[model samples]
Target: MVQNLNPATVQGREYLAIPGPSVVPDRVLRAMHRASPNIYEGALVEMTHELIPDLKRVARTEHDVAIYIGNGHAGWEAAMANVLAAGDEVLVPSSGRFGIGWADMAEGQGIRPRVLDFGSHAPWDMARIAQTLADDKTHQIKAVLAVHVDTSSSYRNDIPALRALLDDLKHPALLMADCIASMGCDRFEMDAWGVDVAITASQKGLMVPPGLAFVFFNDKAAAARAAQPRVSRYWDWAPRVDPDFYAAFFCGTAPTHHLYGLREALDMIHDEGMTRVWDRHAQLARTIWAACERWGSSGAFQMNVPDPHQRSHAVTSLRLQAPDGARLRAWVEAHLGLTLGIGLGMSTADDPKGEGFFRFGHMGHVNGQMIMGLLGGVQTGLTALNISHGSGAIEAAARVLAGR
Candidate 1:
């Protein structure tokens, strides 16, 4: 049994480290607290208008942006709807579970997926992508969907390099990105990367509650909109972005409260400036790697990805040897109500060796104290569970954050 728990707990407190539906900032939570306001009037409409350009700025695209009441999956379908017809083939670069699942979703929609499955933890090999695009002599591949950072495995990819590869091969396929895991936390230059379409959600790096998804698309993708045979209005991107009028962004009336929450979250991002937020995430990512390394050197624990540079700063997915891995996580949760992440869609080859790898999420409204808490919990939990790990992970992380 756990001991010495507090009722109110301390302020500037313990946080969710399992990623997505991240701890909504108190300001955002406050904004969402009231009953529904008139969808088309007062501050609601004003905030809606303000949100458009600001979202564009964060996406780094002058192109259109669509807001949906659904989650990231909705954004994915919206992006696909704008660019693909029922039978069109899409090239999907599968680096981890999410990418493959996304492709499967497209296939479910009657869009065929041509997969290029690379081993997990590696980026899309440009040569493999180029070769696949090159071999499409009939130019059947309609779009290439790339997941920027596969949250499940903590791997980041080079979209710009893939774009260059497509340009070099003269591949006619459009480039689409699933940035749900990395959008607000990682460096994403949509326009610069020449991405035709990209999708993200509020739950991860946006520091907002779930229930909102954004799809950004360039003219090339917008052009394809008129050509798609049938588009489910709710999941269609073009209409939502253009929205003849403001009400259309949310379809009929609105997910009124969600927009209120989103407005404050976006405001926070702006106040910090997106560039600085990206830098903060990058720095924190390095700190996480240092901590993981200190533990990994003991051989009792290991990171899923071998290369520090390749792993995500937003989420760290690591494998811990058991009978301690599961116990350590439960120990942390029971002791402090601090929940670590469970491995999701980790395949047969990976799961049999361990109970399930744990994940650390550092995205959205997170800072050093929270990260330190995460490491501290691990340090204590390892001791509680009698697992071996190097001490001073918290100090190493503090040193990194301090340097930043």
Candidate 2:
């Protein structure tokens, strides 16, 4: 007979500190908790229409947006299918795991991905990118796919700098950005930054569950889509761009509950203001870094990205000795209620398995107290796990929060 082991009861509210699928706000949860609405025509339809404008506002763009009934991967496929066909070549300036993942997705669509691997801990090398584009006299590179803030490495690429490099090289290749991890938490101005296509999902900075993905496109990207040989009906944005009703918006049965949650999430974002939200994420990230810096003095832990300016405000990746990173994560969740992000395979030249790193997310709905709790939980885990760490980590974090 199979034995069923009952899990221990964990007291108090659990903290989800993973990079994406951030803790949903109570208001968004309540909005999603309600019953499914009518799909044909009603308040749901009107509310669904409102999402595009608000989404554009969050992206700080006037370009068009199409909502897909899928996760971030769907947005990736949609962006590629519309602009690229079989045998089309795209330049992927890889800084982290997700950048390579995007290249793999492009390959699935029969598009050739020319990747310039920049390892894991650093930002993109703009000079190399510029040279690559400049060498492509025929402009065989249809687009340059850049990840704005790679959650795996917690490295934030400068999109505007890439745009300037392209302009200087007189490259006509479209600039496509994957803002899945940075959309609401970091500063991204799609149109102003000269991004032709931007992709994001509901999970991360959007402060919602993981069902919906968005693809924002400018006139240039739309023209590229028009020039493509053929795009699958499901991935095509033409019909979904101006839908007649909720079903048409999604190309099938609408994600009614997600829409409700998204509406509430967007409301909260606008109410708090995007600038303020970005500032909060920045401060919390700094606090976490301060704590990690103080802890690193004992030679047990260090931040993945050494330079603070190059790191993402949404997530911070920390490096520790083997087993300690993994053990600390397990210990925190079992003893306390805090859950930290796994060390994704963002390997540097020295550390290949990436078992030495873990990520701390400070995006969406997360506040100062919540961050302090997260840091406190980590400190407890370090002590409980018998991991060697310098003292004053908590004080260091508090000082940062106190702006001393």
Candidate 3:
């Protein structure tokens, strides 16, 4: 028999504050409740036809977009498939677990990866990266991969600056970005930022389940793709963007439910307006950080991000008092029915120095009340555990949200 896995729901209100599989909008969830569609039918075909342009608008690129029935990792594979051949050289800047995973994927594909790591929190040294590109006289780097936001650390790197660096040095490397965290939550301009290829998943800012992955590419990347001698058919962007509805949207039978979910998601994004959505997220995130700062100054807590602007508007990492992080998180989950995010790439958790860190996700359907509820739960947990913390964190967050 299956075990009772989760704690009982919080008296009809359980909070899923984990970074991904973000709170789904009721409309989107309802959209997925219907039966599957005939892949070749009129509505499905017409819906498929309308999807690409909308998806492109979200990515801020008029270039090609491909959808796959997979997660963000598949998006990475597809982007790489279009651009890399066996033994091709690529430069990878890893700031966290996700970045390292991308480099490893490239390696598995027989692409030679030259890595420059910037830890889990900060962005790469721009001058150093520019010099590296300038120093590569042979132009051995076929592509340069960077993560726009490292979800694990809630770090948002400057993609525009990376593009500027490439332009300054006249680097021929095709620039790629993993915008999984920053896509809808954080402001990302693919064409404007000179991102030749970009990838993302559905679970984060897309407000959906973990079934869809999107890859966006530009003319330069397409041209480079044409030059690839060993592009995988399944991952090839050109084959997928066949100008026909069926081939363009799905190579095999469509992920009908996910398509429905995506359609609703897209509608919600466009209706709310992407710009306004991003601004709302930014406002909410600032409130969270403000609470963290107020708590940190009490000599009991601190935010993991060194700079406020660099911290992702989608997620925030908080370092709590000594050796109580894991315990406190467990207590919160058990008692309040709230799920907190783990520090994916951090070293010291529940340590003697009390460097335990946790992350809070404020992406997609999250809002002022959701954030307040989350912070309120954290405050409750801290008090119940008798953990030293400054009071009024929730109030600070409320004021931040209220524009006080």
Predictions ranked by TM-score, top down?
Answer: 2, 3, 1
- For candidate 2, the TM-score is 0.96
If scored against the real structure, what TM-score would every candidate get?
A: 0.94, 0.96, 0.95
RMSD per candidate (Å) reads 2.3, 3.3, 3.6
Please identify model 1 stretches exceeding 4 Å from their true place: 1-14, 347-350
Evaluate candidate 2 by giving its C-alpha RMSD to the native, one decimal: 3.3
* Residue range with the least summed lDDT across 10 consecutive positions in model 1: 2-11
Query: Which candidate wins on TM-score?
Result: 2
Clashing pairs in 3: 322-354
Against the true structure, candidate 1 reaches a TM-score of 0.94
Q: 1-404, model 1: which lDDT tens digit per residue?
A: 43544644433455578968788889999999998787767888788878889888888899889888888988888788778988899999888888998999899889999988885656677788787888898989989999999988888988888898888888878899999999889999899889999899989988878888899988888778877777787777766766787678777878888888888888899999999999989887888888878887776687787877787879888877654566767767767778888766554464564464778889988887777788887887776666778766777777887894
lDDT of 3 by residue, 174-227 (tens): 999999988889999899899999999999999989899999999999999898
Q: Over the stretch 1-404, how does candidate 2's per-residue lDDT look in tens digits? A: 22222345357689999998899999999999987788888898888888889999999999899999899999999999899999999999988899999999999989999999997867888888888998999989989999999889899999999999888888988999999999999999999999999999999999999999999999999999999888898998988897655576788988989999999999999999989988998888889988988999897688878888898999988888876888789878877778999989755556666666789988899998999999999998888777888889999999999999
Structure candidate 1, residue pairs in collision: none
Better of 1 and 2 by lDDT: 2
> Model 2's lDDT to the true fold?
0.89
